[model samples]
Target: MRDASAVITKKLYEEDAYRTEFDAVLVSVRRKEDSVLDVVLDQTCFFPEEGGQCPDRGELGGLSVLDVQIEGNEIHHYLEAPKDALPEAGAGIHGKIDWPFRFSNMQQHSGEHLFSGTVHRRYGFENVGFHLSPSEVTLDFDGVIPEQDIPELEREVNAAIWSNIPSVVRMTQREDREGLTYRSKIDLEGEVRIVTFPGIDSCACCAPHVARTGEIGICKVVSMIRWKGGVRVSILCGKRALEHFQKLHGIVVQTANDLSTSMENIFPQVVKLKNERQQLLARLKDASLKELQYAAKEIASDEEHALLFSSGAELPAVRKVVNALCAEHPGYCGVFVGNDEEGYSFVIGSRQLDCAGLGRQLQETLGSKGGGRPEMIQGSVARKREEIEGAIFSLTRP
Candidate 1:
């Protein structure tokens, strides 16, 4: 095996991003796993995996390329083919990239560049980080950009997309790089590859992009969240954005039909349904609380302990029951909800005994998970009612 460090992979994608079919020499081949082989090519059109973007997926020598990575100057193509299935080193091989996939990626990358450039130009926020996956693209910024202002950015990006601005890459040498302006994460020296979209964006990028902005189709900012000190925003472009909008509209339409209201009235209809749900829950809680309290009272004043289980009772109602029983009961008082088969959620209280001690006993003995103050403890345990009763009664009062 020759040192791949000396094997320079002529990146044909840089020459023409649209070029899908190409032939290259198999410079080096190594076995990474029993089922996987890593092969390096001399000159290839496949783009290796880089930060902010995934590697191009395609076939190399008729075998599916599992992954592509750039190490030193060699572009490694990972394939699931056995060594016996592949040709020997120095053999000429032919492969073609997944064109639609590559085009979509190009659209997304170019769209991101345009949007980031617009934000930098208008709001002066530098793009601090980026991640591009098959399903989504998230761009991080060094400063905050409110949700309300993102519409303007989207409009600007879409306008640029529609303008069909030509995409050009300027290979600037270190000596000629002086006085030239561009957006980059690092202070680039040496020969820098600068991809420019006319007046919109000029940034140091090594990925292959579309020939024109119009090829991006459209740009849409889907969501944003506050991050470290700035914000991370998710965006969709081209067919992806259109598909998203289509899916969302379908959901809205279905929701409106289910609610028996027009799309425009869905919000009010949902609010109405929510109010009805709240009223029903309030009534349920009132009934549950009264029933639980009545059960508590049924425990004679002479009784030292009380344990009540109400299957449909809410936690708040159970807690109230525990509180009422503890006011009189001298021993442990607890109310549990749920059946023996499904386990139970419980609120246990004691006036004279230590509930925290019981909590630990429950946790250690039955592997129950929860804790609270000494006076009260709340947790869930899967033990049957009989087992739980035994565990609680066997422990001496702490």
Candidate 2:
């Protein structure tokens, strides 16, 4: 393996976060995998994946940069291109970062810092962990922030953003940092890079950020859930926040239209429909019970097996009818609810046979599902009534 630690790539991004283009000389190239080369340059404007933040993406030598990672002091640019097509070591190369992607990450990180700072100030909760990616951003706090206080906390973050506070980046020398108070998730060994938003937050960090809070656009706290002993808060910022809110607004509008009500009354309409559905179901159940009783009276008093096909009857009504038939008949008695096309839910009981065995036989023969005790069984089957009747009625006592 090549000793890349000996050769440190100059970090242009540390000097200028918005440096989208840069010229450099290739220092080394190693094959990472098929069509992927880990190319190191003398200097780079790209930011590698670090500190819970995703790497900056773009192109190097006109080939797509797949990912970036840091090893010791060297930044490895994983490029997607045939080895022969890439420039050799010592050759001049050009690198470009996708500005939109980089800026979006900056907004999210800055927004997170602002929110965490607010929580720390008010509740003394430390940000235990954080993760930032293109699709999601989450901050895990060491203590719970009251749910009611979150709205105010979120408002405070946006208020700071609208205040347009300038972000200050400075290295606190280990010698001069005798009594420095800053938010840090870990103990520092040497000089600490402190990112500060005056009167908002001051935290030890290494990632490049927006010049001012206003550039963050917005921060929307989407959810907070109990995690570990504290809470994990998910937020959306800048373009992602806008996109998320747009989708949510679309759902509300469509739901209101479907409910035949104004957007503001969609909730009330939904509640009303839910109540009405319950009332209708109760009426249907009462009618099904009466129908089952009438059908029970029509069965021959001395039949070998009493079987009835019922429609729209609930499970309780069907089970009641089967139990009543079983008391007066010598063989299996069952009530099936539903038609040939939709499949059937059944309740079978017997006074003189093992219904559990019958259920197993039906399951193996008819592709049905369910089971119960020896005296009774409940299950569903997909076969037509003609096949089900023939199977149950033809059975003799075991």
Candidate 3:
């Protein structure tokens, strides 16, 4: 028998992706101070996180394998359940991987390959990056892609998926890797694993993928964002795509019923509501400006300080009122909006005193927060109205 420490766990996942469970002998168990056990198995179907794919999680002998890692060509399973007696070295254990999670990853990964290959061939752009999760896959391209071309690209991807092309994995020796071009993010030195989709693409990857394009079911480009002078596209494949579409459809139906409109007319109704809102806001701003001007004139005297409080008022209107008062008197003019517990939105200005200095002094006195230019300052303060007014009146004494 090979030395326990010298044992290399067979990677059953690499050979047969459908293999969900395996019986393996424990080679060694290293006990830690924290009571967790790191066990080395003679064989495992669990895939460790590598090459941008998340690691597989499952059960080992009724205990959870919280994590699996690769160290020095040996796969170590990090087992939890500290209170349970640790399995001895050379003991047999049954390992079962979460099949649904593994299959979801496989579908998204394989779907990305097909879609990225389509993009590369159609536009001559390189797939700069790829990320696969259980819910979605994102592909980053090295160059800009025209927005007009996205719909056609999506069509091409779905066509390939419907074709049910075989995804073949071939292993080749280092010296014989000539004339076999494939897309790879890193340089390879040892035996290379090539994943090829007939009439689509070939790339070097170690992650387990679905055996056929049709297994991806459907592919949807849900979103695209400009990233690092390129483009990042979010995709949903297979059941993920179905679930996403169903959720969005539900939202649309709810919106249509709420608006009392048909699904096709939801867009026009939303636009109408937005336009009406803009008109109402314009009228309200006009009325608020008039009201503020009237309130400013009602101050009665060119006093050293004038303080006003209004509820649910616009900050811009408050600033205008303060400006009008500042134009008339060389005193501190301020406005406070909102309530005591939540703090007040304040705008203060002065021609006689340095507004910035006054703001700093108030912040120091009340331990508040805010700042400004020499003539004007604006911020929110947690202090109450009476306390704030008293501080300002004291600072602006003639």
Alpha-carbon TM-score of each model against the true structure: 0.84, 0.91, 0.83
- Report the Cα lDDT for residue 114, model 2: 98
**In candidate 3, which residue pairs clash?**
none
Clash-forming residue pairs, model 1: none
Worst 10 residues of 3 by lDDT: 1-10
Put down candidate 3 lDDT per residue, 1-398, tens digits, no spaces. Answer: 34655677888888888899999998888765465778888889998877767788899998888888887678888888575577888789999998988888888888889888888888877888887755557899988888888888889999999999988998878876788878888778888888999889888988888988899998888999998889999988887888898999999999999999999999999999999998887887677667767777888675667778765568878888898888877778888877788888888898877989988898888876789897899988888888988888887776
Error of 1 at 100 (Å): 1.7
Cα lDDT for residue 35, candidate 2: 95
lDDT preference between candidates 2 and 3, better one: 2
Candidate 1 per-residue C-alpha lDDT over 37-119 given as tens digits, one digit per residue, 9 for 90 to 100: 89998899899988579999999888999999999788999998965775678889999999999999998899999999999
TM-score of 2: 0.91
The TM-score, computed over Cα atoms with residue i paired to residue i, of candidate 1 is 0.84
Q: List the residue pairs that clash in candidate 2.
A: none
Displacement of residue 394 (Cα, Å) in model 3 is 8.0
Scored against the true structure, residue 375 in model 2 reaches a CA lDDT of 95
* Model 3, residue 224: C-alpha shift (Å): 3.2
